[model samples]
Target: MTDSNIPVTEDELHAYVDNELPGERLAAVEAWLATHPDDSARVASWRAMSDTLQAKYGAVADEPVPPRLSLDALARPPRRWMMGAIAATLVAFVAGGSVGWIAHGANTKQSMFANFTDDALDAHKLYVVEVRHPVEVAGNERAHLQQWLSKRCGYQVRAPELDANGLKLVGGRLLPGPSGPASFLMYENASGERFTIYASRATTEATQMRYAANDGNGAMFWADRGVGYVVSGPTDRTRLQHVARLVYDQTEKTGL
Candidate 1:
């Protein structure tokens, strides 16, 4: 047991996420976090961020160290340009929008919620390019599409109305997802711009909405009621967010 009088610090929260928290204080911090929604959510976000980074880089950690980086090599005299090159590399890394750069000042990288958004982004990029058969079902049959998807996905699936956002439903299809079957829906505006929404059963019960960008595409991801949703579109943050807001609102009202 820990003294409730001793307040938990930012460092403690991070150590908890890293699984390095001292056993003596662990119970107290957990008890405190249970009553604090903000801190609990922050901890969840950190765990998700850590999971995302591990999924991406864990393999690299297992690779053998390069000969140039070995102890024998370290004993040799360094080149004059080595220091300058190291400095330049760090600068370029920060400027290149790497995940480490995101962790430098803020928790923006916490926006990544494991593999859910990655699958969504990949699906969006894959089907958005189709001029012929983009979807298995056409948008004209919205009711049938909804029923079919709902049955296959084992949940009530509703397609949000996005006409107000100038995006007309281009239809949807079934796809393999992280957990189980996924429903993929596409939308398009008059200018030929495209967007997609992907939903499926999620291991995560709930999460705050977060944004992630890949290649040239962007995604907003959130989970609710045992389902995960990702809205993917152009890298224009404002436009993507606007569409995502509409989808989120509809899902909330309709209870999907």
Candidate 2:
């Protein structure tokens, strides 16, 4: 699709996926997906991932609280004359605090990725389920779609070539991005399994390569220059990486 209609930012997408978006905005995304096939498939993969993650990790919220982690115990002070015991407890607390900090860091990263993944999948899921108007632009209009997206994003955008990898370019759509607007291209195998290559101008500091799985969805994200790219699906890590490499190669070629 031509980029002119792409939203100014991906915040709407984030809100949509997180179920925080309301009324017209949600309706707008749904309407866009209804006509976009490639985007629809990507949304499906995202939904599967979200569902899988929720099923596996949702229980963390319900887990039993350990006595040492109880708020009551933390609020209580050590009794008088317990100097040695208090010292030991303080040491343990420091060690535990360090570990907790590290864990929190990791979790924060996961949560951020999950939010993006959820947005991608939600967009995919909503549009793919439609019988008609699945894309704002059809695959048959590749040249037009490319030109439009490129102009809108203020960068040359090309659909990554996936023919050699047993997937065919189904088409693409312009979507909102963190910095501005972005695009998502969908590819599929004969079995109907699909994957998406999503890209946007990088708005955050450069982040190291990272892999994560949510619900049953897999995502690989990396940033370079001022662009961020994420390739996501329910495919195995090897398959996902293979696609990711192709996307990276193509993105570089197109001057991402």
Candidate 3:
């Protein structure tokens, strides 16, 4: 392992799930995961997905192709009109398959954003532990923080007031998101409980808020006007949803 303090990356998580992480790094990753419940949950999800895929397709790889799809069958001669019909059918099939694959690929790309929750959770965990320098800009400098994040993110970024929900803005920072530059805002309540909001360019234009929770962490994700937003906090679903709704309402009113 490079260093205990070095952050574990998304690729490293994947490698760990695949059992391909280097031996030297294994202990470090495992130790890091021990304290990061969100990451541990993500690892478990990946393992489950891998197991499900193997169970569903493992037999297919060992099976022989159907006779109709064999080279011999394809090479057999046919009447000229039959050959013409086959060619026409094949052309139609290829065209339809191409369109199908394109649509499937697009759907796949959109679905990949579900992983964005992981990124939000990771950022939440990384900074929430900071005692003094939790954010690059302090909450007192809200105007500057918002303006800086907006300019860098190429979007109108707003740090929604959470006072009504018993949370106050702590600060914000810029981050690299799945799509592009992201704006991250942190909020803390009187008890020092912290929450974060991550916003960035989105693949989808608009979406309803959806919740995902791992261990003790919860996040609600949505997209609007070419931007995606994630609200992350502790795993209190009702409380988290209330906070997320406040953020959502503010964005709607401000047209962000």
Candidate closest to the true structure, highest TM-score: 3
Candidate 3 TM-score over all chains jointly = 0.60
Two-way lDDT contest, 1 vs 3, winner: 1
- Per-model CA lDDT versus the true structure: 0.77, 0.62, 0.75
Return the TM-score for each candidate structure: 0.57, 0.53, 0.60
User: Against the correct fold, how does model 2 do in TM-score?
Assistant: 0.53
Q: How many pairs collide in each candidate, listed in order?
A: 0, 17, 0
Note each model's CA RMSD in angstroms. 22.9, 15.4, 16.6
Candidate order by decreasing TM-score: 3, 1, 2
Per-residue lDDT of candidate 2, residues 1-256 (tens digit): 3343555234554455557676656666777677776666666665664565455434443445433223353245532323443454566578887775555545544544554555555444433332223456767787998998888788777887788989877777776654356677777665556677777665444666667676466777877677677887764888788788888887777775
Candidate 2: segments with Cα more than 4 A from true spot: 1-115, 128-131, 204-206
Task: Write down the RMSD of candidate 1 (Cα, Å).
Answer: 22.9
Instruction: Report how far off residue 114 is in candidate 1 (Å).
Output: 2.7
